[model samples]
Target chain A: MEEAKEGFEPKIIGFTCNWCTYAGADLAGTSRKKYPPNIRIIRLMCSGRLDPMFVLKVLLNGADGVFIGGCHPGECHYIKGNFYARRRIAALRTILKQFGLDDRVRSEWISASEGDKFARVMKEMAEDIKKLGPNPMRDKIL
Target chain B: MKGTELKQEDLEGLFKGLLDKKAVDCLVLPHKVGNNVAYMLVKDGDKIESPAASAIFAPSFGVNAANIVKGWTIPERVGIVAKPCEIRAAIELIKLKQMDKESVLLISADCSGAFTNQDYADHAGEIGDWVDSAKINELKGKGIAIREACAICENRLADVGDIIIERVDGGKVLVAGITDMGDEALSSTELSLEDKDVERQAEKEKIAADAKKEKEELPKMSSVEELEEFLRDCIACKNCRDMCPVCYCKECFFEQPLGKPVGGDLLNLAELRSAIGVPTNQLLYHLTRIYHVCTTCVGCGACEDACPKDIPLTRLYPLIAKKVQEIFEYVPGEDAEEPLPFITYEEEELEDKLR
Candidate 1:
């Protein structure tokens, strides 16, 4: 973890839905395609299951950026779950800003077969969050 | 109208008449108990009494009653006796697809006042199976019957009810229809409703002015620690959760099988710092609940009334909810078709990025 945290190296916590984004991530590994090492993935059944506090908790726990990838619209195994997740992420982004931690939070839609796009999105998000620097909550780390 | 007093018999007879005549399935009405008002279910408008013991209030009651009717094959048409706040809550719930208004009816009445749970207990001394409105009105002219939230509330007349049973004069009440269903329902009732346009206008104006003032004074904690201190006794009793109308999850995440309890039981510093399986983080629990139900919070103040520890959760939830809506422009329960705040986005949903 320390080696991965060298100067200007962003620690991105990615919450990917198992049905789509998670599968896409797995396929990326199987295909021998390399992506940024800074991205750490936690697979959830549905993006709708991701709670707003979980984002805050991750940021407060020291991640420089938090990325949420879910199934494309109307493609969720749990129909309309991605739609709900979309609204939740939009609301979460606003709350993050109120706490002055908005730049580090990002959300997008990805399908099960978009491994190449997933890699590119992660790389782009990591570069954007790197410009924002380390999370402020890191100072309070006990 | 002056305070002449409303009897239990009067309300019961009025509501029963509505149900007997196929006017409504249920009435979302408040019953007076020991000087406090409680919103409860009036089955077919019979056995009319205060549902103070039923901690859930209007906004939740509307959706709950709607769900109950939907489940039962009978009562294809149901009615909800609600307050203004409940009507607003029902609107949000309807928008969220949590409720179906097709089989439901709304019979809203003027809410004059009510009492907090603590105040009701203090007043209901010794003789207590449950108190009703007649005894409460007996203390009239002495200022003994008033809820803290009600006293501050300006939205006395509900704008959303199909039929509004308003206290018009000292000697009579007006059962008027604000909607087409209300008009049809009222047309069926034998009670006469004249066009009292002036009286209705005055009452509505007074309420609007009062609501403006009330909105200005919405309660909010100055800091994060202040909120933490206010919610100190939450302890995950789930009273607020149960009372809330919009928290409709069959099983909450906090109550999940894998979700272990955290905090409480250890005394040592190391154990205290690292206590596992303790139901701690009251703030996290509340924040999650607020996020889940923010769009649907109707500000009915039921959660605070139901809390055994008197956490003032009603005030806090609404405060946070207002902030969420302001930041996101997403009002829960307003329009069923409008996407939920967290579910959809606009071109400039992140307009604040510029700020």
Candidate 2:
């Protein structure tokens, strides 16, 4: 895969579970962490409600990468929400691989105390996606 | 208990006896209908003409007779002669509580395979003898291919509890009763079946091996743009969903399309993205339906046959369904006691699936 030109900025869609990941993002903002402003976050109450279709549609609609941040396994405020979401994301990744888009979609556990980790993940994801260049679907579907 | 074996000519008599002996009140099986073979519920003993020999099996992997009997709740037993896949679909429906299992007797005949409805009509018209088990190779030699789903079907034989009927050497119909009820049913008649378990087991192993090889060899859609191009010819017709035995929804979401505003969801999306395709929701409809049926699809390929666009949906669904179903270690219709994977999960399961 050819890398994008210098200064190419990746567009990422972040679906953050409000219980943990949303709080983590908020903590990062308050902490004035240095990270790329590539993600537009959508706050979901729980990761379980993160339907695979939503991730798929957003990716097909041309987002350079999709970032799903959820509560750590067995620590979901809603109990078992992240467990279910884990299974869905895993299944989703396999589907993504079939479409050669596996690298652009990832799930991470970012608790409220992991604000530093949240900022770091975004910066890393943005860099990787930038290297991958624009999503091919960006032209076909959008 | 031993059951007698009868010639191919006696299958009609066996059905007639089932009615006369009051074993079942109404029978659901394929019979001659105009020039085609279709499922019919028959109670009259006189109407039990042997199904066209070729037509009996040619309808397999296409029409799902299980869907025909899905809504039955009566106490009166109904005998259903269906392909093994249909029987499997029926078993899945039974576990879903979608069908009355106690009121039905599953009858499966020997299945070589079936062509699509149009192909079956053309092939049958050309050959003139509905389907002779011996001539199936000859039929294939004439440039007719079996439906894609049938090509990889592993469970072609009826399961242990089914009343399996097959034409063996010398044109003799071998009827086997594997359950107590099936044994009693056969005992009442003048037929018996010996155990051909070793042969059938070998055949099943070969089918499974072939399926594994085929899955590995499939050409997967490798890009979102390629996927969109593959699906671009869709005409928004819901025929595939309609023909799906597993899509047992009472009223589909598309059936009652909600009125849209001047600048609705599609417009909002288009404005955000700069462009969007019209006849919205085809991709959503297909993906949603696949998610819903992945564990219970039975790999029957009826949906593929119903596609008007000639989409190689059979190629798409079975491969994807295999991936999802493997995650659960579940094969739909393979077991009656097995709960659907989506609803039943162990606490320790799918641990590696997470981040």
Give TM-scores of the second chain, every candidate: 0.69, 0.86
Q: How many backbone clashes does candidate 1 have?
A: 25
CAPRI-style docking class of model 2 based on DockQ: acceptable
Q: Is the docking of candidate 1 incorrect, acceptable, medium or high quality?
A: incorrect
**lDDT (10s digit) by residue, model 1, range A30-117:** 8877878889999999998887778866775568888888887778889878767776776666545534566777777778788887
Evaluate candidate 1 by giving its C-alpha RMSD to the native, one decimal: 8.2
Best by lDDT: 2
Candidate 2 chain A — worst ten consecutive residues by lDDT sum?
A: A90-99
Q: CA lDDT of B272 in candidate 1?
A: 35
In terms of DockQ, the best-performing candidate is 2
Structural similarity of chain A in candidate 1, as TM-score? 0.90
Candidate 2 lDDT by residue in tens digits, B77-127: 888887888887888888877777678777777766567767766655654
